[model samples]
Target chain A: MKAEVVVIGSGISGLTAAALLAKKGKRVVILEQNRRPGGALKRFTRRGIPFDIGFHYSGGMGKGEILRALWKYIGVWPRLAVLPFPEEGNENLRIMDSGKVVRAFFSYDRLEDELQRVFPGEKQGIYAYLNKIREISNTIPFFNLDLPLTPYLHDLFSPKGMSLAQLLMSLIRDTDLHAVLSTPVFLYGVPPREVNLTIHASVAHPLYSGVYAIDGGGQAIVDAFLATLAEAGVDILTGQKVESVLIRGNQVAGVKTSEKEIYASHVIYTGHPTSLLDLVPGEIFRKAFCNRMRNLINTDSMFIVFGAIDDPDTLGDLTWINYYNIRTGLDIMDLDLRHPEKSIMINAPGRRDSDSTGASGGVLLIRMSVWDEVARFDQGVREKRSAAYRKWKAESADKMIEQAGRLWGDAYSRIEPLAIGTPLTFRDKLGLPMGATYGVRHSMNQFSPGVRTRLPGLWLSGQGTLMAGIMGASLAGMVTVGEIEGLEPLWYEVRQCR
Target chain B: MISDEQVYQQVTQIMAEEFELEPESLQPDATLYEDLGLDSLDAVDMVVALEKAFGMKMTDEEAVRSVRTLADLFDLVCRLKNRQVTKE
Candidate 1:
């Protein structure tokens, strides 16, 4: 059967695009490679202990935010059980910087005050940086849904045009501020430094307003999307890997899956854009476009420790998310997982719905490294691994657990490791190219692909298309579908969504 | 009642698809751990896959410990389905 649109890869972007297009009365069928629908946001349970894959929490889910409106419009907000991050310094997500434990705050004002309190010597720099981010946030079209499209010239000249690293250095001479300021880039999935002020502002601004995690973790959002898609009459075909985007002359006609062919006039791809080279006929894209995509650096992947701490006291003390840098000298830049010269420490106790502070339990995602360290073992088969490689992975997890014990104090000792997902796990299980967690690296001054592709009907979406994380991926879906249906209508829907 | 051949085929398909192994490589007598080298995570995925494929809910988690061979899995699934059928 021919669909109005064939949405590939059922991540946030694909689901968002399918829902929106389906709402517009377009026949859409989302083809997911995995047996399950959620792309990065899929949650799984082991011995009844729940763990979220990509999704931890989201910002910009607050009132009047474009992300909030989009979620409501997509029927996601109502289904999701979201809560604010702990505002207090002790219980709140802690950042260990240069032997100083700086707690993160959800409120922008609170964050600023805390930063000022901690870095009293750099008061002027702190104020300037906060003001700069807010200014950068203003330039984002999605942030102010009421505003018309942010003009290209505005983008070229604004603070969004500068690198967050460059901007931070220029504004604050303090090294700690530089590391702390760019931590938002990790939310979008890059380790740090590569993210520019524009990408940084759009992705980071929401967290300062309010950041929230779901009650059932990412599963809640995925389940909501499934219900919405069903209600909207958007057919979902899981485990259907699109082998190729079939073309008729110069335009995209449809796609062929492993089992059967799905014909659609339009195809919105939500996977890593690099994978597109295999699907779309190579001749359709220009030489430069192909090369850029081929060499497009993936965002840094992570070594996630998905565990449950049953100790009620420790669990209560633990927060769901944190960017804990255990390594001193404040080198957030190079986290060499091999030598353990640098490390990213985060202790998130996976929570059961019964308790807020994860007294029941939760998960912590520690940034292991960029793909370089684990790329050697990428060729190994998933089901069967060489004993040597398996031993290495086991040893690595053991070391991380040991580090957690050191960094998090006595609470960490009681914590038991439930599951360890390495970069290889993501690459094998999730199908992310090189296990890059945030999709295509959203680097400053780099050429990232937009919604439109040279191939007429095949467009791009997902994290790579716009910003990273749920908000970015959702916006990207809008951008891609807007290319087919008018952007004005999406904007109108965004405004009208209550 | 499901035939032994039908049960074997279903078991083979689910295990093959889940593990990304060739179906022909799996024999009824072949051990899941030793022959297919299916690890702990792979076993979890296989169980989920089995539930979907056979449309029968596995009652006993202990079945995972005992279901070592493809034949063992076939019998486990058949028994689960048979129990459901009898109950229904």
Candidate 2:
């Protein structure tokens, strides 16, 4: 089959690129290796019950934000049911050890006011510190304008540029407050010290401002993309994996799969270019370009646990992001996600979803960062690794349940039917490099390759291409679309959508 | 209208409610996670309730590790009250 464009991988990036390119009037074909689309965002049923795989909670859905803007432009905004996150300082964090428990709440103003109250001596300093964070976060690219470069440079000069842990340490001399402020970094699936301020600011601000989750599972988001794609006249093929990017006379000729070869004048790769790097003959790519691609770091992998409890409505709320500092240690990245220091965070969607069937009860979504080998656990001894991973998830679940029990007591027992996946699942299923959830880490000085590759008509997209999560992928998609179809037209389309 | 005992009792009640424990079970020596089994999220929720109940602000540092026992939290209530007293 011949097409004007072929998009490999139907993940968020692939879908976004395909939909936008097709909107530009290009005949597009999308190839997904999975029988079901949505990649990590895909959902599966447990005993006829539907559960979202990687699509959990997100922030920045406020009016006119990047996420809201992208979804509205793509026409997916109408389909989602937006639920407000717990107000700042209303977020619940429960820490349990043995039989003892500690609870914490976070609201930005409340957090600031509380800090002043605690350290009356540093009242002015505390407000100044918090206000600085608020101000800097507001100035970030996605928050205000599309000047990704502005936030990037601001973070480079700011305290956050050093490292989240170091920045917090300098701001708050108090150890406990440092822990409190730094605890939320768990959501990014990385420890504070390893996470750069640029990445943290990008994630933390929107959340600090507001957070939201898509209604009827995240797959509806995929459905929305499909809706837009269909309207734009794009052809999508699921369950097809591209074997090679056919090149002729130093250009992308087409893509060859096992069953057939599809021709396209322009090829936009949503999957890892490294996956096809081996497939592309050496003579085609400039040595320098190949070197740059080879050196780019793939993000880390993660473990996800999703379940339906007997009383889902009674569990963690939609915006309930929790963290447990199992041990008093400075080495955040070294902490194993599979075996933790006794702290775990879990969220239940039933509490805040006033629109749910109530019978849908509570939806338990648990996430953790794991080693990348998780995706390759099925080949020979690798199969044995699956058992280890299942055990790890069970242990993690028990820890989560224990923490929840402290907060919800007997109500926690109602949680049941948990499904688990490790980084291996992401690697094998979604074609991620290391089962990494956030693409490559967006560090202070880390130079991310633009969507366009040296190979003409070949471009990159997705979290790995930019960063991870929905907003990042959408922005990456927009940039890729602009590059291919011309930025002015892309912006014009955006204006029209508005 | 709120007495010291009332504030103390309410603080204890927040712990009990958040941890799903009885007020009597929450002793001053009870460590949050080790004895009462509360995770970090519960700590955050407890702090929020405390803020509303006492009308006194609590910092993230104080909330994260300060309230280890029933007495530790009771003392926080006292501090919050002290602020009201000083203000008055």
Candidate 3:
């Protein structure tokens, strides 16, 4: 196969990059390893209940927002159906031990009001933190959309040294308040102490601005991107794993997949940064550069239970609420990885059929976990795994269900474990090393790999390149494509879309 | 505290290792983009490498963009290191 550009990995980043490039008159081909596209955005059905794997809800979907502008520019906005979260109490943070629940509303004023209502003494600190997030997020060039691009690139590349923990310590004194404020860190899979302040602010500021869920879950997003790509005349080759990036001299010639070789001058790799080392020639990148990619720290993975609630009446308002149940007095920064039950996120993406009298709702029970928990069971593929691994996985799911039942009430006990995903499952399915949930950790301690590499035509995108989450990955695609076709013109076009 | 001479040596060493340039070729006046063949991407990585090597936060955008030669980088490192010491 021959094309002007070959984009490896068909995740949001890859799809976004392909759509944008194809729209700009470049012939693009997307090679995905799995049978289907949409890396994490892909959804599965078990017993007729659909569940989202990676995407749940996102921010910056409001009118005139960056995500909206980007999606509109890429032609996925009109096709997508976004349902905004309720104006009040979109997210509920529950401390299990104290039974204290703090709700976060959509708007800043309402969110502040709710916080002050919950923590009466910490009003001043809450204002400072939210204002800081807004201030920092406004300075981000693309995130702001109105800001000039060149001058702020330096700020994005060289982040401020202060970690989120340090910044929070300077403002807030209450420990529980700290946990509530830092709950958004789970979205990016970084601890508050290690996550950079600017990165955290960027992630949190959007949610504060607005939060919305897609109409049909993550698969809807994949369908929208696939339709847009098809309209743009971009070809998507699934079940083809890119084994190595074919290099001719100093430039990337194309890629060699498991099946065949596709020739193209420009190659965009949106996979994990470390995985790049195995695909490229040993001599292309310097020893230090290669070492940096290899030694890059990964974000923690998760142990997820995908099941359904047959009776929607059991849980009132099943659609809008995202529950973060944390063990009381436990530092939310460090989730107990050894015991997967310590901290859990319960999300119900609404009932399948709101009009049907017998409607069942899909619920995802996610516990943050480390790869070491499932390392012993990582010997084979998903189906071919040993019986011991299956037994361990079933046992782990039972414990998570038990914990969820204790904290979230008996509605969770009725949830049959239709599917369970461990770090091994993530590693095999998403092709991330150690099943690192968000790829490389964007922490204060390390520098994230740049979009451009030592190789002339090979570029990097996706979570590892920039930030994580749907918005972050989409921005990575925009940034990588912008780097190719001058940022000024692209930003100008995106601004016009807004 | 590290002296200016030691800082210069360490900066040059890091540059050589990171960019695969020989230490002998890293002259004080060698241009980063021209003589050393570094691009904009390399400049970003250079800041990260220097920051890690010196154990200091190189968040000064003006200093990073102003750097054109090996001497400029060494000067930036020295200034940043001194700034860290004074803050301490």
Q: lDDT for each of the candidates?
A: 0.72, 0.63, 0.83
DockQ-based CAPRI category assigned to the predicted complex of candidate 2: incorrect
Highest DockQ scorer: 3
TM-score of chain B of each: 0.87, 0.79, 0.95
**Order of candidate numbers by TM-score, starting with the best:** 3, 1, 2
Residue pairs in steric clash, candidate 1? A349-A361, A349-A362, A350-A361, A350-A362, A350-A363, A351-A361, A351-A362
Report the candidate with higher lDDT, 1 versus 3.
3
- As a whole number from 0 to 100, the lDDT of residue A403 in candidate 3 is 77
- Candidate 2 clashes: the total is 60
Ranking by lDDT: 3, 1, 2
Q: Write the per-residue lDDT of candidate 1 for residues A256-318, one digit (tens) a residue.
A: 999999889999989888888899775666444565577676777788767666764653445
Supply the TM-score for candidate 1. Answer: 0.79
Candidate 2 accuracy as TM-score: 0.73
| Backbone collisions counted per model | 7, 60, 0
For all the candidates, what are their Cα RMSDs to the real structure? 20.7, 20.7, 2.8
TM-scores across all candidates? 0.79, 0.73, 0.92
Residue range A1-498, candidate 3, lDDT tens digits? 899999999999999899999989999999998999999998888877777899888888888888888899989999988888867546788876677898877678888998999888888999999998888888887568888776765456565577888878888877777888888888998888888777898789887888888888788899999999998899999999788999887899999999999999999999998988999988898766777788788998988998777775786655677878875431575655565448788887635323323454678888887888888877766458889988998888888788777877888778778899999989999988998899988887677888888898999999888888988898889889989989788888988887
Candidate 2 C-alpha lDDT tens digits along A1-498: 999999887888888888777766789998877788787777677655566666666777877677777667777678677766555424444323332222344446666666566556766556655666677666665666544442343223211245777777666675445555665555555567766666676666666666676665577778888888888878888778778888877678889886789999888777665565775776655443455456555556655566566754455443354434333333433435455344444655433344556555445534455564343445632244556766766776666665556655556655664576666666666666666666565543234455665567777777655655766677777767777787655654564443
